[model samples]
Target: MSAPLRVLGIESSCDETGIALVECAPAGEPQGVPRLLAHALHSQIEMHQAYGGVVPELASRDHIRRVVPLLRETLAASGLGLEAIDVVAYTRGPGLAGALLVGAGMGCALGLALDRPVLGVHHLEGHLLSPFLSADPPEFPFVALLVSGGHTQLMRVDGVGRYELLGETIDDAAGEAFDKTAKMLGLGYPGGPALSRLAEQGDPAAHALPRPLMKTDNLDFSFAGLKTAVWTRMQRLEAEHGQPIAADGMARPRADLAASTQAAIVDVLLNKSLSALRRTGLKRLVVAGGVGANRRLREQLDEACRRRGVRVHYPELHLCTDNGAMIALAGAMRLQSGQAVAERHYAFDVRPRWDLSAL
Candidate 1:
């Protein structure tokens, strides 16, 4: 077998601390499918859930505690060592400052120790490139819908490091809407997943949630209105019931609410994505970020794209959520594209708000 260029990736943008080892060779060469040698993730969801949201200091502390051990485990699982690693990649910006520092510090330290090349990967770029990790990687010059808790944006992705922001949310992101609406419904913290699960049985028709900016010519979105609509509907429901909707009632009405909310979100996302595609004149669409994990969102995008003869690509379910694999894969692609290089100074700082357009 030909020697494969192995890469170690570290991701710690928020509550997730991940480490992965991936190998690369010529795309169609006979070495093997670009393979995942090993991967590990440490989620701070449970810890942060208690606080209803991620506390940056807490997230940073967790990363320091988990990164080293996870790295050890990833290497061992992949049956490789520091010597086998060809490059080190880490997420550099657009995340909690503290958390990004932890990952960046760890990654740079590793690279320096191994005397290997290292690259600073944009968090969104990692998400955009995530689909390439799959066996059926999409060609470049595609449209991208990036939906996460902290961001909602559409982009024209021509290649690695070549991205143009088509549009973005002017207000609350779709994930934020889900979280806020879920809280209004007493869904507790980290409401996006919980709400999605509940939405499975909701009769979307039961509530006529507003599709914000549905008719706007701009690709920009605003979920604040939709979230307000949800709040208003819940208040009306409570007034009608004369008591707070019981947790038990949540089960009976959960599916309908979930379906409706999910539908509204799906509609907005779908409409905006298609609009971006039309404007870019690109038929292929890629959905990334945490919200991309939503089943309904994926199904709707796939179905709609199919009808229009456009294509839609998504990262694997595991990669859809925050993980180190994407960071690693993005780094590998950048290196292969000669777009980035290792740093001589190990004093890289985290950007809590890095713009993709800046790349």
Candidate 2:
């Protein structure tokens, strides 16, 4: 039997700094999902919240402060030393350039210091495969719905590194729409969760909102129109009430709008995901990324997929957002599947804009 490989993963793609260690069996050794030894994450939500959203420079600086400490925490939690890691991995792109660089630089430096090979992981690919960390990991040859802060994509996943783009967003991504609409409704920063929580208090049919591209023949998504529709509705509501709908002590109307807005987004995602599955004739579906954590989306998708006899999978709630465990797991899976290799080279680069389909 070959020795186990320990992978240390670092993620600083946006507002979160995460570090984790994962252990995988040697290549071609009857591989299963990699085991997460320990992981730690530090979210910049509080710091960025004061600014209404993430400030790039603040995010970068915070990553600098938190990465090393979080690394030590992960190692301590796992009862492992740096010497135990055989490979190092980091998120390489499609994020704030400064934030991406912080992780990339740390990863390469760690590899050089420890004399270990390092791998650069695609950010979205990490999200796409994150569900493997769940108790019910998925098998290959399934459809994937990747919905995060700035990206909404549908893809066919045959295996590690074998992804085919089925459809994608043409304008605002689902998460982006959620945040923007939340801001318009006076919801606080990190608005998606807030909006979703509020939505639970009101009727989804209270206000009519557009579901962009829901009835379209293709799998593509569009949320820009939905945001506009929400804005118009809010304006109408304010005019009718002679005050802002989000005014203090006016929680009911806000909840209703939140519910209606959430319904529109979930309706589109649910229909499009089902359509993608039907088009590919796949029975299994995997949903990943921040927006995947939305309760309404999960509930609707679960019921819909159950009626259709399709299996749906998602990462554990905490893993739905950006995290290092996904990056390490992706690297380990790639090595196990012979899709990528950890390299000895120390020079590194970051891609602020990467197309997942191109990988």
Candidate 3:
């Protein structure tokens, strides 16, 4: 019998450097989900907070410094060494060019050093399969909602590497809308969380906000217009107060605006997701990505799915953000399903704007 394959996964897609080890059981084994042995993640939120956004060059440099240490930490956590790995996988694209290069270079270097094949996993595929890492994972033929930083897409996932695009954002994604609106409120970088924190103190209906594409017949999304609405509201509020917006976010007006913006974004997401589930007649739904960690989105989804007799699955809160576990799991699953082959050729390049549906 062949030994289980140990896959080392590296993720340096944007502002996070993640390393994780996943063990894929031999094909004969009954276990379908790859076992997550150990993982480590380093977030550059603090570093980028000062600039109120990520600086690509700085992000790339930081990934170089952090990737090695994170790999060592992951190995230590897994109680394994370099020789045990059979395959090395790294996020290949749909991210910053420099950041993707850092991870891809390190991963190929490791593969060469260890005489193992290397695989390049898609970033969105990583998120799409992330829920499989959770304690309660969903089965095949499920609807998947991928809501990462700049990407907001709904897909019909039948199995590993079998993804059918359902609908996606026409303009700014949901996460982009959140950040853009939060910026208008003077919330610093990584504004989604900060804005959500303030929204807890305000009412969603305190201010009227437009829900774009709500009446549309199709499942597509449009958050860009909602951002313009938020900007207009902020301008009007500043003029009404004869001053710039407050920084504390405790002011009722700002808090109300934040809540309204969040409600608008979440409303579109929720309605579109439900519409997908109905359209596909799928019983299970999996939501993945950083924005999936929003408390409001989860709460509303739980309630709505329950009423519709639909099952909803999400990656653990910690795993919702980009991480190596998702990337590694994606690689392992693809190989196990015979959908992708690990390459002996280590030379690499990155696609900054690769289309997930193309895969």
Question: Each candidate's lDDT (Cα)?
Answer: 0.85, 0.94, 0.92
Clashes of 1: 6
lDDT tens digits by residue: candidate 2, 1-359: 88899999999999999999999997879997899999999999999989999999999999999999999999999999999999999999989999999999999999999999999999999999999999999998999999999999999999999999999999999999999989998998999999999999989999888888899899999999999989998898888888887797668888999999999999999999999999999999999999999998999999999999999999999999999999999889989999988999989999999999888
Q: How would you encode candidate 1's per-residue C-alpha lDDT over 87-166 as one tens digit per residue? A: 88899988988999999999888888888777888988888888887767788889999997868999998887888888
- Model 1: worst 10 consecutive residues (lDDT sum): 26-35
Model 1 — TM-score against the truth? Answer: 0.94
lDDT of 3 by residue, 281-322 (tens): 998999999999999999999999999899999999999999
Candidate number with greatest TM-score: 2
Q: Residue 339 lDDT in model 3?
A: 84
Candidate 1: residue 133 Cα off by (Å)? 0.9
Pairs of residues at least 3 apart in sequence or in different chains that clash in candidate 2: none
Q: lDDT (0-100) at residue 32 of candidate 2?
A: 76
* TM-score of each model, in listed order: 0.94, 0.99, 0.98
